[model samples]
Target: MRMKIAAAAAMALTAMPLSASADGEVNIYSYRQAYLLEPLLNAFEKETGIETNVVFAKQGLAERLEREGRNSPADVVMTVDISRVNELVERDLVAGVKTDTLTGNIPENLHHPEGKWYALTTRGRLIYVSKERVEEGEITTYEQLADDKWNDRICTRSGKHPYNIALISSMIAHHGEAETEEWLRGLKDNLARKPQGGDRDQIKAIAEGVCDVAIGNSYYYGNMLMDENQRPAAEKVNLIFPNADGRGTHVNISSISLTKSAPNRDEAIALMEFLTSPEAQRIYAEANTEYPANPGVKPTGLVAEWGEIHPDDLSLQEIANHREAAVKLVDRVDYDG
Candidate 1:
């Protein structure tokens, strides 16, 4: 239901510099690159008549947010992954909120169960199969990637990466640790290429005929298609939503939360609701090639073309909870295979 009242809601590589200041504005340390979010930021400023200043960084925002502490001027924190969001909560860096708009806009599992954070965008870590090489129904679920039919023909990014860890954690939530480990082992045995590069590289490999199937998040394909530069890589393979028969495919989020000592508490909460509102949800989902977290807001062109999927109903916290087990399993099994 689109609430008539209102609603809710890095840098590791590009690690861009943080913006020192922007007069009469919230300082945003965003993990998304400058171009990816420029349109929305520009739109936010135009609509509200408030200049929105954002600094792009990956590894250092959490530390920086922590260091700024009581004196920090950040009105809102925007970043990726549940573990990192939980880190802000764990550090008491985020504030709990209760807004009718948010409560109605986002589902329970997508946000912080306590409202410390709210999801803005979603990306499924789904299976990607080469259209020409594989039978259409041969691979439908993530579990099928481990089948002997795929032996020595899989390609993926390293499991140590947070995206893969989150995916494995979702698997743990769905299947328990033992079954999850066995699946990782099976997934490992089928690698055609050593785990390397970003999701786009994995998709590009499929385009190059390096593997029969690849597992990656959804936005990589979206960004590729959106960016004139990456068009060739974007067209190589087709997306496959996995595990539809069981728990559904694992999904991840890019979300935001208010800083604990926000100078502009009202502004922060207002921004949260603004981001999750149907209008903003539509913009983020369409422009960024991510699924909108607000159930009422249908994804625009990019995601619509990819097809609808049922997000694994498991809580985001459960995925973060099982991160340790996932890492241990990946290491023990040499997931780099």
Candidate 2:
């Protein structure tokens, strides 16, 4: 019966309009790459016999979904960063979902108050310092990036980037807007070079001795170590979970949402629930060297070797709320200049 339902769903997907939702099929529009999601999707298919379809893009997915409106074929939307996911909520593009499985598997701080979205995995905003040039305890907090001892020693990507914006937003939540502005000015004054590249480039800059410390996501360091060509550079730096002993490291998430126009709501919910399962969480996190959002699932492989992370308890929504201020502060300080 399951196989018959699955086959029928697959055929319906092929024959019907994109907006048609079938009983045993789920459709996903994702900003995350296809390769990362394949394993988890495959497992979901095998277990529940639901057919899955995915459209992967780097940008414009939110716009696409907005244009499609009620006819949109997207049942689930997946992407990284709080700002992107929050955009779905702000635009009313995604509907809230409440299920015991989802709420139970994910933590309170990680999900929306009304369940508009749920995070699947998290990556820390890490500090990477040249292992040889910087000594232990030399730099231990995000606040230290502003200290005079590190003037012309720090490297980072554009402050306007969503990742940095989210981090800056967290700072505002902890400190008032006035104090965060001062901190931003200090951090900007300390830049080794005009912030010009992605997180990986900052790591590479460290390897080339262009800077002594860089701000980056934890997964990039792990991914670089896994690549033979990048391994040498990666090995040159030590990863720091800043503020670990105090407020804990700031972490960003990769998350999923149920589109307001979900054609196959049941199948979509099934897939969402499956993703939070221990089996799916393990496969999902290990694929990209990320920490599982499901706290019961432990980090493995190279991610585990880096040691445990104590994530900041600040609510992601609180961080999202301050995004505009963070961007303004970045520009006000001329951080990229």
Candidate 3:
């Protein structure tokens, strides 16, 4: 499995490097996998007669663009996680863009205030509890993760991973840094094992009796259910949209940005607007099993079956602002150790 993933990453990287492009073409450097973005790109090309060229990599596109400077051929940068998109903006690899359509389609909190990036899709940070062990209504809030009764029953991925950091950042946003730090310490004490593995592994752990509950993103439940071998393990757990009754569920986005060096700025903007359109947003949600950034669009497939998500009203930019403090709290708790 590791070899296959490595080979896939290698093949994705070997795709042609972006270069100065023709009039009707837009070049993209994406951390998002090809399968995830191709449907949207294909639809854009078919509708507008503009070509889309892509070079995919899991990391380092920001540094590469920094090195290439003004000569970089990337017109758009696409990636998952706000931290990554924020990194591009911080490095000055992305340029702020504004359009009436874009501004109208995305919520204020979901996009950068300066328009440097826009969220394409979102997913909730939810809890999954073993169906056999945890009863309905037994747990309902992020604050409960730290409750003493749950000691030795909780599981999580590394606290340093962007997903957890984002969740922790939200904690910092709602509670002050000091209170969040205390919560982290208590949450750490509840762990079934030292924080390890991806979200899916946590679900798998619940099935194996390694733990009774786990924290993970909502879409991963869809992914696990889609796999034949993973479905049983997925069925062993039930999802809880934490904090639904209070601040609403914490959510994170997969984002897109306009590059500072865009040579095909017009065409790139066209594609960007196309992605925000209801039609393309629906297609994206259907293909990825994630919530559309455009509220007018509805999710399909298993994600739709999971039910409507009430996203936390807190500003994501503010949450991003607290990320550094969140990381410090994680270290202070020795969360992964």
Best by TM-score: 3
lDDT of 3 by residue, 1-337 (tens): 0001111253444354655856788888888777677788888988998888777677877887898889888888888887788778778889999999999999999899999999989999999999999999999999999999999999999999989999999999999999998899989999999999999999999999999989999889888998999999999999999988888999999888999999999998998899999999999877777899998888888888888888998888889888788889999889999
How well does each candidate superpose onto the true structure, as a TM-score?
0.90, 0.94, 0.95
Candidate closest to the true structure, highest lDDT: 2
Query: Distance from true position, residue 316, model 1, in Å?
Result: 1.3
Cα displacement (angstroms), candidate 3, residue 300, comes to 2.0
**Tens-digit lDDT string for candidate 2 (211-281):** 99999999999999999999999999999999999999999999999999998999999999999999999
Q: Candidate 2 — which residues are off by over 4 angstroms?
A: 1-19
User: Could you tally the backbone clashes for each prediction?
Assistant: 6, 0, 0
Error at 150, model 2, angstroms: 0.8
What does each candidate score in C-alpha RMSD?
Answer: 5.4, 4.3, 3.5
Against the unseen true structure, what C-alpha lDDT does each candidate score?
Answer: 0.79, 0.90, 0.87
Worst 10 residues of 3 by lDDT: 1-10
Q: What is the TM-score ranking, best to worst?
A: 3, 2, 1
Instruction: Give candidate 1 regions above 4 Å deviation.
Output: 1-24
Better of 1 and 2 by lDDT: 2
Candidate scoring better on TM-score of 1 and 2 = 2
